[model samples]
Target: MERETESRVYGWEPGEQAGRTVGREYAELVGGLLDGQLLDVTGWTAADRAGGVLLIADLGLYGPGGRADYAPDDDDAAGGLFRWRGDTA
Candidate 1:
């Protein structure tokens, strides 16, 4: 008997329509804690991209520990993914 395996797709791959926006005009987070978060980078400068960080609310925490900071993973920034950095004060 032959067995079938499921295939999974990861990350974003631009299509023909994406050609209009060739640069980092927009960004979206994938994987880890901040998955699916979209950001507008149309006016973001080089410095902004280098130092860009995101603060996300951690539903798992309460009070002062309720938020965390995330920074774009340099390895995956070209693909627009942010990784959890640390908990915010």
Candidate 2:
């Protein structure tokens, strides 16, 4: 296996205290995502030692008009998510 010299993201630098089996796995996954061109991903922590949900304010490489001004679950039109607010909405 060759090291990908051209990897665009930062290398995985984990904290010194490896909490447990779950934490170590999470760290490895995050490292892979970052190396695979995940930009601006932050505040990622394992939830209850379970795999977490990924909320994207911007669709990014996933689709067109990729810049997200608000979170997908915000139910705001200005953010361009166009979530159904209510019957009046």
Q: After superposition, how far is residue 85 of candidate 2 from its true place, in Å?
A: 26
Model 2 Cα shift for residue 86 (angstroms): 27
The most accurate candidate by TM-score is 1
What is the per-residue lDDT of model 2 for residues 1-89, given as tens digits with 9 covering 90 to 100? Answer: 22223223223234422222221222211221122322222443334223322323232444442322212233333321222111110
TM-score against truth, every candidate: 0.50, 0.19
In candidate 1, clashing pairs total: 0
After superposing candidate 1 on the true structure, give the runs of residues whose Cα lies further than 4 Å from its correct spot: 1-24, 56-66, 77-79
lDDT per model vs. reference: 0.50, 0.27
| Candidate 1: residue 46 Cα off by (Å) | 1.5
Name the 10 consecutive residues with the lowest summed lDDT in model 2. 80-89
Cα-lDDT of candidate 1: 0.50
Off by over 4 Å in 2: 1-6, 10-35, 38-43, 48-62, 66-89
Q: At residue 88, give the lDDT of candidate 1.
A: 56
TM-score between model 1 and native: 0.50
